[model samples]
Target: MNMPRPLIPQVMTTPPTAFPARIRGPLLKLCLGAGTLGLALHVFAADPAPVPPATTTPAATATAGAAATPAAPKAGAQFDWSKVPPVTAPSRPGMFVIAPSGPGYYSLWDVVTGNERKAPPVSPNAPYALMTNPAFEIDYRYMEKPGYEPDLFDPIKRIHMGEDFLLSFGGSFWYRYMRESDARLTNTSDNYHLIRSRFHADFWYQDKVRIFAEFLDARSFGQALAPAATDVNRTDMLNLFADIKLANIKDGPAYLRVGRQELLYGSQRLISTLDWVNTRRTFQGVKAFWRTPTFDLDAFWVRPMITERNQFDNWDTKQEFFGLWGTYKPMKGHLVDMYFLSLDDNRHRALGRNGILGDSITHTLGGRLAGDYNQFLYELEGMYQFGQYSNQDISAFAVASGAGYHFKGAPMNPQAWLRYDFASGDNNANDGRRNTFNQLFPFGNYYLGWIDRVGRQNIHDFNAQINLHPQPWATFTAQYHRFYLANKQDFLYNAAGAATLRDATGQAGSYVGDEIDFRFNIHVDRHQDILVGYSKLFAGNFLKATAPGVSPDLFYVQYNMRF
Candidate 1:
């Protein structure tokens, strides 16, 4: 009799050498320690005695073995061999089996029945997706199967606590080059190079508790230019959070999390982590999450983390934020979201009757409805704000709507869309009332334009975009935008939440500008990406009247890699 060949495991022989210089030493040490600890735990956690494999009657076993020749099973007596478990070799006194239980080993029944079983599903290759695996592996495909016991610190088949602990680490390095001509409608032309590095780790125990942490380092080198509001943080702690499972609900689960982390909501028009920036935004506080098959809810109380040029950045206690966001799916392809948010800032400045600055407290209520039907998609959202700003009353509102269609069988699989956005502005400067809408923290570049010269405050934007996927890993986008001030008396705000070009006299025309943008994105593989884009803004009457309107142009190229 010929025996089947035993499967050999694949292991990493050397460590990766692509990490940034600053973190290479620490990261390498951490990984080595984790590997050693995992092996030790595996060896000590295994059961001393192995259980015997299932068996059948002697006569049946003999007959099955005799019929297990190369020939197929008999015609009328087909048997379902899948129901028969595989047989294993009896355990030796002190020998251990490192391999897991899988289909490589077969039984006499399997051979006699001549039934082929289906293979297991393959895992995704993406870095983010692979991070969920319990064991760490250089190649994602070689990672251990979901339930395979590495023997790692797990007790005998207990209830919920039988699962082994998990540890994983990953990081990314990104470099970008940017050039701006007539920067921000000014006479100056500026150029710069930016480098960013991030390292993160996740530790989970028994599927009930998780501790995650991430660190970031961002720097710039090149010609002297005005510092960008989003890109200058040197080194900081990005995220450090703990999540604890509370209960197993009807169709989903509930969790409570505390610490500093990222917050993102639908459309990102009101809140987001702002990943495009070199230094992403984070919040410090607590959040409660509950979900079901048809609906999900989140409630959080957090303060935005303030970024400083120094390393020791802290939460801004002066600013307090709280919100409740809920999403419900009424049907297969439709979604509705409702949210209420509040902001209490002792230092918030509001425009007064005579150009004075006063503190502000604002509350916002909003809802969104989105759906996909066939090849068509549509979304609509509206928000209203009311509160007090010093001694003045606050009343503001905003509305956004968009529609798109995908050409399924087209040459390039193109998607074309149109959008319009409007935010209320202060109509009477001397009425002791403020009406300019506040956008809070949002991903401004995603909705507006790549240049991000205008924000979602007292503004009107009309945009059209076309997206094409020429290949499975590449995308191209072209967009055009027309901008105007919702009220001529109000100021023009930029993505940084700062007023860029304003006319105090309210004599400038409402037209802000028109912009054209082109972008290309290429995914080299699961761990690398390349992005390039260009944008040109044609100054309109208002811009020309307030600042140097030389038709500002911007170009950027960025490369990213993950491990």
Candidate 2:
């Protein structure tokens, strides 16, 4: 019985395997090389692998005596998803675009979405609650070169947290440290650190009513003079403002907002927040903004606020200001704007160190026009500010204009613009007119040598910029700037006798050599990006004074993340 069972194994049959030794080795090598080459290509080219479009087309059919035909729509203006870009759930109901570099290197453009961009439509019956889209950023940068002292670096961040409603509240904070280099202080290297913060709130009521308020606090710490130590610090240079608005009164559509608010009118060459510095220059008075279907109007009365002492009392007391602004858009791509301003400072004295006046009124009026042609964008803006102050009771004025263009046919979307600035203010040696890229009053010179000298005086500047976008998530830019002083120093004589005043430097019309700035950015993921930039400040007499024997050159790299 045992021998019978063992004989059954002899009849067992084996199945053939799928793998063949003849082709197995070549197939394995082919797949491995393909994967390795694909990885190498990906590593060299930053572009993500292209994605194929997903779409479905209607089927075609043949008729008895007609060529193949497709089905026709039962027309009533149906929605066409194919004509629009694919849309995911929108992140929010507003547009946010941000780019950051080193310190003083940030661009923020945020606007409440209307019907454009297919923003979520307003529904009266929908949920009523506060919804906001907030973002923040921080950057650190440094560069190394021989001879020059290592540049002082600091932290910069922007805070924009607020709910869009009848009213909104939020603010931004900033701090910086400027270390005077081994050389003396010429604007190049100053051993001073500035810390500043601001808070603002805006509210709209009854669909047409509005209110606004803002507060600023700042501190400047560091050695006013080197080699020794002293506690002569400056603190709490506070600025406060408030305003109210009334809209759509009676039968006609009109509105009015009165109080303290920074008047940002037109393109900002004339009146702007001057956001370059930490503490912003705010007006302590009232303003009216009226808008209709075809035209909009903006007018204001303001007083420059510098110190916190009697902050609200001296606001519009010595100087009463007024402005009338209007804009008209008759045709598509065409816009026209004009403004008239008046400064009534009766008890006007000399323009003080902080740009305040004792007595005497001044008047400023200007206008601007902008329009778009086939593929070109053009803008023309000019404003004149005239006022009387000082012992001579002299009159000073300023003018600014600019134009820009875009080349849609360019390989990499390209845009270029040119601007000219001519402004006049205090010319005395007093430390007034904070020379900053962002300033309240209309002063020129955004890119001063290492030091900025366009503050508190007469200045003229010419600037140009070109930008290229080779990819949707990357940009490259080049900018050039030059400046010159227009005011000559007049002799000043004291009652004690002789004279102690002379405009030796600026009198001959000081000049700041042309500066070149080049920068580029690469957006990695959705919330992060990298930036690289270089700046060369040509040496000028004014620059030398701020930093003797110093050639200002800066190179920086930074990574930014937003949330």
Candidate 3:
């Protein structure tokens, strides 16, 4: 007969790995905060119940005048404890022990098991030892032992209000070389650099409340070469917000946030922080977040923060923005996003098709579906706009779609993708309806092309891209794009929302031009990255008919680091 296997008892314990030497300083600070949290939990965690004594099988006894039958052998004989080797106790407390219990099973327990004494009844000022529970104990693996070394002021880590806080500082420097031939009137070129520095701090209160703030100083140098690239700003407050945990749900917790912050949604087609720009976008607002394992929802009401060339930036009180964004991930690698946004602007420039300048209100409804399955990936998005612009009726729409495939076993881990985009334009200037699509605030450079010469309004874009990872740290990309006017009568708008070319007579052809771009990225290390890129555009018939159709060329090299 086969002997029954004994089931081993398991204990929940922390892992044994320690933080690496290089990051020990930062990790220690994190641990200090965690240790404070552990202390707080100790004050609240319930006392563990008493451990029962080890159970033993009673020996068989013969009754008076009755012969005791030999105890029937256990159905599956247990190992004789006398014949088994004894386990040596751990040399230190809190160390784990794994002992063989029977065939194919093991028992895991702490060396101090059964020896721990029960705690006294609760008291207002209990001794530290009474409040110290192993479940709430701080793992020294994540931190240096207390009194192991002298204390030092770490900028990135601190303790305040009996709680743990963190403070950090970081910055980036960027340089670009830009040249354009026959840019409407003259050939122009410029070399400029941008310095962006920021300081951030986070304050937490027992995982229930958090306050965050960041200050930024972004400025441009050598901009005199091209006065048009004035994306500079003096020192200013970027983000200041308070996040409060509202309640716990089945999958996770909900949060309410208020104050000045950055708002970014899927793909950033309609709303974004636009971090690529020297002075990024931000908003003063109230936002609510509800997240679960399968879905997330965000709703907000805000006004855009206007970047004043002056030292202190201000909020645009006359303009209000509100939106609801939600994403659903029903399965791994698949995602769907839906959103509705409303913008109300009191500025005079936000006018209507009838040429009246007044307040404008626009509402946008859109959704995106994207997924990656096996080696194939796809994305699709569509948006429709309606409302009132001054006296005219507002109506417009846009669509973007992309598909790609990865060659799993191919050299270089190559992948290829194709994408197309379309945005509506005013069909007839005389019409009372405004049809030109508004891009709102977006990362236009990423969507239009590497050259970033066109806006996402009244345009048609077709693009193809090839990507290769030549090494674990290096990537190469080649892209081609064809541009066209969605409507012949509409103006050719640039990324800055300016008309680069227009044919009032509506005789200009639709074909704009074709562009080719090549780029390479190298992630030198965890803290450093390098990028190099070149792009060339071949002028088409419409460009030739409207002005000097000189082809444009661009090249740039960039390096970035963080600490």
Candidate 4:
């Protein structure tokens, strides 16, 4: 057996508690900002100006990059694979059905944020009319439509059952070359290749019942260090679930799904599919949801599926996860989301000053408000957690806020946004109370700078982002981030939510550093995309005081194709 190398960032076991004195001020400001965001949206929605039809923006997972189809594309569908509430996807696109808000794994960025940089291109790779229009890789309902052209793969994509049954196929390939200099300020460098591929089969019966199964194979090669758990999960089940209609709603049907699957929630700050990793994340459980034009609701309970290289994976019986989420669209281009998420884990064992410890249980309650009004947009989310870990009390909080402006017709179709994020940290290690916020499961790569030197724990980030669509087939993004420790005495967390460096005393200073990142995306045609990115981090006083103080640079090129 190969020893597992440390992944870039894994969820932290240190539960956070307390309301730090330093974060209180910013907390108040963020609270006010959230309220203002809601009010402003209300005003815009109430405006007497003639309301325009809901704009259909390219959601994060909207397919693009294929050669333009000679035939005009069909009207795109709004159905997605996310069980959570996402901000994009047309508000009232036909009758609602069981669709993902936006499958976190299928999208490059946070689909919940409506942040896709370019309009999707028409699909030309599929011969069947069912796949003529590009859709997120997870959506298979299109196959139910009766249509076909002579093609080997087309038959596998749509096989008719006796009467109402239909079977479909879906899959994709993602590859990347990763290289870094002075990673973690260790004054070391390495280059490696990562490859992750997936295939799935979807079977449906009269749109009332279904079975979906997906398989994954991920690998890493030519690395100086052993591959992390995230890099290898050879021949494993990614998703295997059964769905049954519970009731029929206006535009769709409510569903109760059971088995192994993935979970994604609003903003994906706490619960996500963890798609950035080679193997990604999944769980064995059940989920129930109903999607409609006016509102959406979901509930679920599950155990995280453990990934094992060269072995059959199974659910970790020691943990339990459950959540409830609801989204309301009060007016066009605006939405509100509320959720409650909790986890119970028996994984951590430690000795207190006294005896053996107990299990860890944590709960998170939060809400988000977001909207797009006349090229101005904003998103705000806040979460507070209280629980028990190893007999210690836990209390923690996190907030993320962003405001941006979109230039629809300006040069380069540019968009600029300013964002701020904060998470609490524990002041004393042995204080019996933890304040460092556990990130849970998240798409940390997108929230923090891509250099991945930091995480959404014990940190404060002031960042700015600019996105540009320079051509029909290309997009560019640039970002600058300034980071500081929420509590100078807390540990400095890596993007994986693990504490790699710390200053027990408050003397090292809170300044973590600055990071600049740039990325370019190009679409060869519908099934292929190429991405190039570079990131540089400037060492701050905190590192100089605690470690080597060496800054790091990272570069990567990625390719993705779906079939």
Which lDDT tens digits does candidate 1 get at residues 6-101?
Answer: 111111121346333433444354345434533433343342222222111110111122111122322442432211111111111100101111
Candidate closest to the true structure, highest TM-score: 4
Best first by TM-score, ranked = 4, 1, 3, 2
Candidate 3 on 461-552: residue-level lDDT in tens? 89887777564345577878899999878888876566677786778788888989887766443334566788887887777777664677
1 or 4: which has the higher lDDT?
4
The count of residue-pair clashes in candidate 4 stands at 20
Worst 10 residues of 3 by lDDT: 56-65
Candidates ranked by lDDT: 4, 1, 3, 2
Query: Which predicted model would earn the best lDDT?
Result: 4
| Model 1 lowest lDDT segment of ten | 91-100
TM-score of 2: 0.53
Q: State the lDDT of candidate 4 residue by residue for 352-431, as single tens digits.
A: 22454667777788988877788787888889998776757788999988888877666666778888999998786566
Winner by lDDT between candidate 2 and candidate 1: 1
- Higher-ranked by lDDT: 1 or 3: 1
Runs off by more than 4 Å, candidate 3: 1-186, 224-230
**Model 2 Cα lDDT, one tens digit per residue, 319-385:** 4455566655555445566666655555644454445655533445666665546645556655554
